[model samples]
Target: MTDGDEQVSGPAGGSGAQPADPPVTGLAAPNGGASPRRRGPLWTALALVLALLACGVPGVLLLGLVGDAAGRSAVGRKDDPATAAARRLGVRMTAQLDRQASALLGGDRTGFLAVAESAARPDLTRRYAALRALRVTVWRPVADGAPAAVDGRPGEWRLAVTVDYCFVAPDCTPSTVEIGTRWRLVGEEPRLVAVEESQAKPAGTRPWEVSDLAVAVGERTLVATTPALRAKLPRLLAQAEAAAKVADRYAVSGTPPDRYLVFYAGQAEWQRWYGGGRPKWTAGYAVGVGGGHHDVVLNAQSVSPSGMGELLRHELAHAASLPAEGYSDRSNWWLVEGLAEYAGADGQPVNRHEGLAEVRKLVRGGWDGRFDSLAPADDATDDRVGGAYGVGYLAVRHLVDRYGEQRVLDFFRAVVHEHRSLDDAADQVFGDPWPALHDECVDYLRAIAG
Candidate 1:
């Protein structure tokens, strides 16, 4: 998927770990809760991950990352030389990760005591650091070449682990995790070569101060992370749920277990975890990893008239519809994004005054395909941050007036289907490829503004 160019992609701390055995907890970037081993510990690390999953904690990031099969082989045979040698090294790394993750998740306090007390030993003062939780999940493991770098010199390998973590509210937010660690040989056992904490506003340098963020509403997770932002989440989510409920009862039905609302401090923090930045919508987008099941990650930090509800409507639309289509420029860019903008804002357009002002802005800029078609809104500083969201935002407003809602949905359905381009799907929607109606859409938006 394309990076949301206008925004930011903070440094990804530790990324991509073993064949996922979802671990319990971990944190990073914002908080130094997890410093995944940058050195040796292949077999033992992954085995512990597998053990955690087998032990029944759903600790894994759902993004598909594979673990090393060769490493696992050592575990099955007790006498395997590779397994015997790496045990201490592996145990050290796993214990470290386990300590951090457990603390981060606010796991059983007694359990934390038991492990720490049992594991302490002589000579290693590094083992006595105060504990903090790191919410982590393994994607694919990488064998560090620290061992091979000096040509047989003493070395360590790393289990390149991808751990996705967020400030979790006990039961208010839907929890998901995929635990895995990457084992790449380094100079010794897992050692800290790098420790990156996302200090930006998007991800934050520390946990959000949202004590009242979580409130269970008829089985739905809702949170208000801080006093200032806290008041807004309820209204926003309430509106969204109201919309979804309408769809559920009258339009669609039944929400999935994974569906959740995560309230953060601001736009940038949300971006750190899930922002793809702003891509030229026309070229299409890539959602999480190789792009499947996930869509634009949403947070309440980004708001205005273009704030929360409308913002979510737009983003969530991309998510809901992506399953029906693949995010590629080869597909109908117009149908995918335009259709999403259309669907999301359907019953939820910005207030008429704000909406009209937005139309005025788009009309003045003139809908150049260059801006709206391929450039990301974040980069459109000349138009402020509105970018083409305003342009396409209004176009959606117009389509609902012209073709009826089902037709708009039909366009999305076609665009969503694999191997089909927006142009291919055009005939089904407007009875023309995008360029054919491009000018017409521009004119229609301008006329509405006038």
Candidate 2:
């Protein structure tokens, strides 16, 4: 149950005494032919006459040319039969999607399944049930671009569909993900046959799509666990709700998500679900779905009940503060991880003694005293990673001590959410340039290290 075992997907990093999980894995045209003709002597003579007239053209010939131009314009204005058919199919698919969305929102399983092919219905049924269990409030799937015709498949088409969904009602913002879908025309009706990963750009798999879930809805949280963990739902839900309250205190940007969605992943799910390939040491992580909404995933087998609270607080803080558009600059890793560490350590010690010891070690080893340099390397040992998390916590604590919590939060929002430059954000929030602020933080670290 090490504190640093949790990771956050996107720009912001993790917090606590345990090793940090690795960064969240970010998820991301034609030819022709021709022919020739032959002509007789009379036709050749007529063609020669026409060619001569066209060079300086007779008035009637010019008028004929104008008429031909007008005809070409008319043809260009009208869609070809193939194009017209595709348009009609697009309309039908749009209507079908609307109906499916309505059915999902209204909990009409039959209606939702009406447009699905028999082969796809079983998987869709499972998905619908999972969404219902998680209390999904919104499920809108819109065609991203025009449906593309599948090669050599006359009645079948492929489309990129973007789906928007939300678990909590009214106050919850919809998070979006894209899927590649295959559809076929069954007597002029569009039938969904498959929903799959897009080869061009892959999206993270939702928890419900991974396995059967047992859900527990709390006042400020929704915990979805596997059937094996159903008996512990009450305990997990309670821990999440408590953590949400602590995290709410740091939600300075705006109202926190209507309900913090948490997923408790079983052993198999822990590896395959929600942006996979996390280090084995990772006990939990938070991933942004879209629209400023992030969902937390806990490795059910790895994290203990007692350790869940700190991890939840750290992740929920990310859900509360990370922008809809995630940050990419790794230089801001310290502030990103530090803020979470700060919020997570609320009412608890800042892991001070261990953090200071690490800082002292770095200083004595000819460190440059740059906070940016303190983040753990990708292959860093657990002890080294743990030390990085410790130093990050102390750095944030220093900010809170010098400037009040609100000011620190304002600075974080400006840089991370608002995407302002560090110098500009620091000067705006703290009345000093970033370099000055950086030097001050370094001085504070050195003093504490000593």
Please report the candidate that would top lDDT against the real structure: 2
Q: List where candidate 1 sits over 4 angstroms from the true fold.
A: 1-84, 91-107, 112-158, 162-221, 224-233, 246-257, 267-307, 324-337, 348-355, 358-361, 364-377, 382-387, 397-403, 416-419, 428-435
State the number of backbone clashes in model 1: 76
Q: In terms of TM-score, which candidate is strongest?
A: 2
The sequence of per-residue lDDT tens digits that candidate 2 reaches over residues 216-333 is 9989999988888899899888988998998887775767777788998888887777646665446666666666666788777767666677778877877776665555556677
- CA shift at 45, candidate 1, in angstroms? 17
Q: In model 1, what is the error at residue 57, expressed in angstroms?
A: 41
Error of 2 at 290 (Å): 1.7
Model 1 per-residue lDDT at 423: 65
Error of 1 at 16 (Å): 28
Q: Indicate the worst ten consecutive residues by lDDT in candidate 2.
A: 27-36
lDDT of 1: 0.37
TM-score of 1: 0.53
Q: Residue by residue across 1-450, what tens digits does model 1's lDDT show? A: 132211111010000000111122332221112223444444455455445545666633212212233244445565332333444444455444555455434544444343232223221112122112212222111222111111132242333343443222332222223222323333443443322232221222222221222232323323334444655655666755643432232121123323333334444444344332332221112132211222233334334434444444444444344441134342234344454454445555345423455446655755454323432332343332233444555565566677776666666556444445556766767786666565666777667667
Error of 2 at 86 (Å): 1.1
